[model samples]
Target chain A: MEKLRLGALEAGGTKMVCAIGDENGTIYEQVSIPTTTPKETIPKMIAYFRDKGIDALGIACFGPIELDRDSEKYGYITTTPKLAWRDCDIVGQMQEALHCPVGFDTDVNGSVLGEVTFGQAQGKKCVMYLTIGTGVGGGIYSNGELHHGMLHPETGHVLITKRTADTYAGRCPYHKNCLEGLAAGPAIEERWGRKAVDLADCPEVWELEADYIAQALTGYVMTVSPEMIILGGGVMHQEQLFPLIRKKLKEYINGYIVTDELADMEHYVVPASLHDDQGIMGCLELARRALENDH
Target chain B: MEKLRLGALEAGGTKMVCAIGDENGTIYEQVSIPTTTPKETIPKMIAYFRDKGIDALGIACFGPIELDRDSEKYGYITTTPKLAWRDCDIVGQMQEALHCPVGFDTDVNGSVLGEVTFGQAQGKKCVMYLTIGTGVGGGIYSNGELHHGMLHPETGHVLITKRTADTYAGRCPYHKNCLEGLAAGPAIEERWGRKAVDLADCPEVWELEADYIAQALTGYVMTVSPEMIILGGGVMHQEQLFPLIRKKLKEYINGYIVTDELADMEHYVVPASLHDDQGIMGCLELARRALENDH
Candidate 1:
């Protein structure tokens, strides 16, 4: 029996990762390249994956994508903050280069799929995955499936509570005090006038960061009520931020709606089991699932 | 062949409705009563349904309820804004009074189910039902099932942009500037010094109200990306608000997401099809579904 082979791409705002893997999410080969111009970068990705002997490919990318079921332009990356990649025909380009079926979706959705298939949310019916890096992106899983509609969920931009005395004019281009503006890594750096990693030891910065995260999580808890919430991204590396965020979430949520799961706060909010490789692994899983359905 | 008899109860903060219906969602008999003491109100509701000879009972009430699969207290009303209904044994009381298998869920969830089964969202996969009454509440349906997890979705409390410059302390005791605090009927009355019904003709009030609502819907659009959004509630009687809200949503969303459904503003944001009877009809539908699943 020939082993099922899959190619995975984790496309971020600043970088792109190309990898070849199998059904088990085991990467046999991988490469990371800086994201500059799509015209310059996509060719290198195609060159790298050309000889991988992959049967299928998946791209986990930032959106908004043209995923309308009725539209002729479905599976095209429509608009993105990454200026060089706007209106980029990612799926078409990948299909032309590889001559194989290409599966594409938002990076967060891919991560949720990866988690549900092989990570913490294995048996869960509903889960929420939040990646807090340059920006806060979220993926929701409802009834064992990725939550998809006309477009993907841009939960990072949901509006959140603002402090009265603290007047930090948030960094998000969209809505000034939205969750991404208040809790994202860039927001932390802007509010304190230093990089988040530089202030890892600073008590005041952590306190404020934890407060903003707790507020955002409070809204998520009230709005989606996921069985489990998986927190990832560069900011979570601090490790110390988790306990403070969990503490503050309990304080903010109150006991208005009590449950045994929430009563044990330590068990509810948890770090991603797959760590940094979740996006790439998720893409591979997406490809496998799509290929299975196609046959 | 005997016709299936279904009992339905629409339990709101201020009122309670009991009805008998069939699988087709046609009500044969119904009763409306003030939401006074739960003991008094629940007994009256049970008496009404019992007198009509219902085979199964569905109670769609304000939540948070115990919906967990393994919980012994499943279907009980846990917490609600209605002071008299807090910690009330709603399912137990009704089951004892009527001597029938009971189905219970949030009123908003019931409304969404009704829309999915018999109204506008009949075949849609992802739908959102938002009610803008004394307070704003919403129900989310994803992948053909009502979205529920830890407790339930409290979308009304999600924070929104504070558009006005004046100092208007929000009405909600929980989160001051949350969506309900800024845009609910009480919020409108407090800001304009008159009831929303009284200010329907005032362009200034509607514009401000539209601003707040559009801000909230912008967040909703970004977070959920529902196929169709159904709006209902007492305050929505001012039909003029819909167009104003749709225009503002386009401005706020800013074309980050491109969808044919949303591109035509007038068609995407629509009013509920069931009008005043949606809640009661939804509860009846819920009861019928539960009965069908039991077999």
Candidate 2:
């Protein structure tokens, strides 16, 4: 079968990217729309691919969204800080307008699917895609599928051992010592009084950041045992973090897992190859998968 | 087409229990044999099952054992402290003698499969069987299968935050402050200068144990999001750890997951219902699956 034209939506807290793509990951056109109210946002997204002739639509939306298909509230973003879009049925509305099968998942899940399908994690079986931006989140893809149990992985909220001599007190609302609170982009800015981009040359900043990320990765690797771990999001833009995280992760693991891949961190820990496009491309993959499922 | 008689082996470090059972988890007969040299141990297990007329065999062995079906050392137990059994191809040896299909997995995986098949986690889609015993370990049953990626989940070795004011330098060789190091049976005995059974009267002991267990569960819950978490092993036998772990897990999670189930600790975190039979029962399930696959 030939590749079908698919619609992809990358829904962030601040903005939404709507694109017309295909199973081949070809983005025909993409338009960014400001996320105001659902009333404002829905119409703009509908307007983008109104007659794009899509076979399916995939929404890689910022969560906690209802991804459970059995639930009536599936595709509804719930309890988000974005009050205007809370409980909004983004997938339902898109499916209603576009009359196409829609695949709905968290942004991080989409990023992982993107990596496995077209980015850094291509050809890998079990993989972890961790994005350390304003928040820390992870997506796990294993055996040709995104893992969703009671809920998709809420990796950002898991607790971590605090780095000594570094007491930022953390900023995550739920857990004070959570990975997101301790090591995310906001945490970095909150601790250093400067954003991650601005602190690119600071050795202490990257080392502390690397230590925390490595700590989180330590838990992730031991529990999930993903073959490859792909780091993305805004904070990972610092090239220095890769090497630092690699060394620290090895030290944290301490030869617990005897494998050649763990020894060679250069290949094991890598930057996202798709970068900013991971979410949207992942949305495209979701759309493609949804279309395939429909058939 | 009827249920086939299966041979089940629960190969622990100190001893091995071999049983004959069926798909319905019925054990026709069982025998316990002391674990000595592989040469002695192999023949004893074979002698016990030789005239059993089994259709398939399953072994739930201790680690670190090679489980990857694609690896050349797939059935060989590797890098184990049990010097006599190290590099022993238990599965291969059994299959050669029995002339039947064989299923191999870690003891924890077998335990979770046991729980999912016949114990507390029965009828659940995603479940975690965690054993806090001589050593800490967990087996994940998701979508009706034991979770095995690059390797099985090494939940015990994952780093966790130290409980306040309780400073017992952890004993896990891999990581300093790991789940096993903080909460396992040996760790508890080491910290309190008495076994968990003897320390039952001491409020401080179980409180600290519960705190560490709850902390580990927080990471597991946030990451795996299993519908049910069944507690097993000797440390979990204390009985007092149950309510404390349930309450502490809720506190650790702290409304991060909004669900009625999270509120009801009575049902969420539970003791293993199959008790000592979980591993042998799980091996029957493994054998059943293996027999089914043979067709």
Candidate 3:
């Protein structure tokens, strides 16, 4: 029996990471490319995977990707913050360049898949993965499958509860006072007039950030009811936010549904175990699933 | 082939309705009982179903119910506003009394299932069903299945983005200013010092209600990104609120994600097709599904 060889790609707004891995997600080779125009970035990505000699490829990209159930253009990147990638044939380009079967989904979805298959949420029937980075993104898994619908889940843009005394107009172009507008990286930068990293030492910023996040999590808990909520991405790297989020969730939940797990606090809300590799590993897992279905 | 015999129960805070139906959700016989203590109500419900010769029963009840997957007490009504039914073994009682299989879930979940199976969301993979009654409740459907998790999705209790200059303490015990606290029927009554029906003649109340609802819906849209949203329940009887909510949604969403479906405001956000029967019929559908799985 031969081991499954797969290629994984995590395409974000700022960078692209490509890796070659076995079925178990053991990366043999990898490369990172700063995101540029599709013409330049796509070619470089193709070149990296081409020399890797893999059998299948997967992509986890920032989206609103056009997903058609019956069409080969299923995984094409349709809309993205990256100016050059809008309406670009991402899956088609990869298939044409790499000459292999390809699987694709949003980075959050891929990250969730990776977690479900090999990380924190492994063996969990239902889970939600949220990445709070340049922007907020989320993926939901129910009954052991990634939730896909008319479009991907975009939880980050949800509205946040505003405090009476605080008045920040918000930074999201789409929604002036939505969660992203109030708490995303750009929103924090605009509100504080400094980068998030610079404010890591500021207790007030983290306190406010945790409040917004905990409020959003309350909504997610009330709506999705996932057994575990895996929080990831650059913003979540701030270790202090975790305890504050849990405390706020407890205060907000109000003992409505008492669970021994949530009573423990450590069990209900936790950080993503895979860290950064979850997306790429999830891509590889998707590629494997796609290949299995094909055969 | 024997036609599957199914029973449906729609358990509202104020009333309990039981109906016998076929696989197509056509009601054969129906009965209504005022919601009272569980000990008093359970026996009447059991006798009614037993006399009707039901093969299986489905229950759609208000939450927060204890849906512990690992416990036999999964569908017990844990904490509901109906104080008389607290800590009651809802599903177990039904199953024991009637001597048949049972399917149990939240009323909102049943409503979404009804919409997905027989209403406006017939062909859609993801749909959100929101019932604005004494309190606001929502059921999320993704990939043709109702979403369930740690407990159940309690979307109504989620906090909302405060929009108005007026400061009225919300009614919800969990979050004083949550969406349900601010926009539910009781909230309207509390805010205006009159019943929602009495205030229907006043456009000022409806305008504020619409603003709050639109803010909550905006959060829902950004978080869930469902293909279609179906609004139902008693408060929605005021047809004027629909247009107000739609207009507010457009104003809140801006033009971030351009979809022709959403571009046409009238088509995307609309009323639920089944009206009051959604919950009962959905319970019938759930019963049918449980019977199929049993076989």
User: Which candidate has the highest TM-score of all?
Assistant: 2
Weakest lDDT window of 10 consecutive positions for candidate 3 chain A: A66-75
- Fnat per predicted structure, each in turn: 0.59, 0.73, 0.75
Q: Which pairs clash inside model 3?
A: A222-B154
Candidate 1, residues A1-295: lDDT per residue as tens digits?
A: 6678999999877789999998888888888998888899999999999988789998888877776556777777776767778888888898898988788888999898888877878888778899899889999887767788657888887766677766889887766677788888988888888888998889877788787788778777777888888889989888898899999888777665577778888878889998678889989988887688778
* Residue-pair clashes per candidate: 0, 0, 1
| Cα lDDT tens digits for candidate 2, B43-114 | 999998999899999899999888888889999999887888889988899999999989989999999998
Give lDDT tens digits, candidate 1, residues B1-295.
7788998888887788878887777888877899899768877777677777788888888877777766787777776666777778888888887787777788898898888878877888888888888888889888867788767788887766575574788887777567788788888899889878988779978887787888777777877888888888887889999999999888777665677779877768889887667778788777877777777
Cα deviation at A125, candidate 1, in Å, is 2.4
- Global lDDT scores for all candidate models: 0.81, 0.88, 0.82
Name the runs in model 1 displaced over 4 angstroms: A1-4, A33-56, A93-101, A164-168, A187-193, B1-5, B34-44, B50-57, B81-84, B87-89, B92-102, B161-164, B187-194, B201-204
Q: Candidate 2: TM of chain A?
A: 0.97
lDDT of 2 by residue, A19-62 (tens): 98887777889899998899988998998888888889999989
Clash pairs (backbone) in predicted model 2: none
Candidate number that wins on TM-score, 1 or 3: 3
Better of 1 and 2 by lDDT: 2
Preferred candidate (lDDT higher): 1 or 3? 3
Model 2 backbone overlap count: 0
- Residues A96-170, model 3: lDDT tens digits: 988888887888999989999989788787788988877888997778778775567788888776665557888
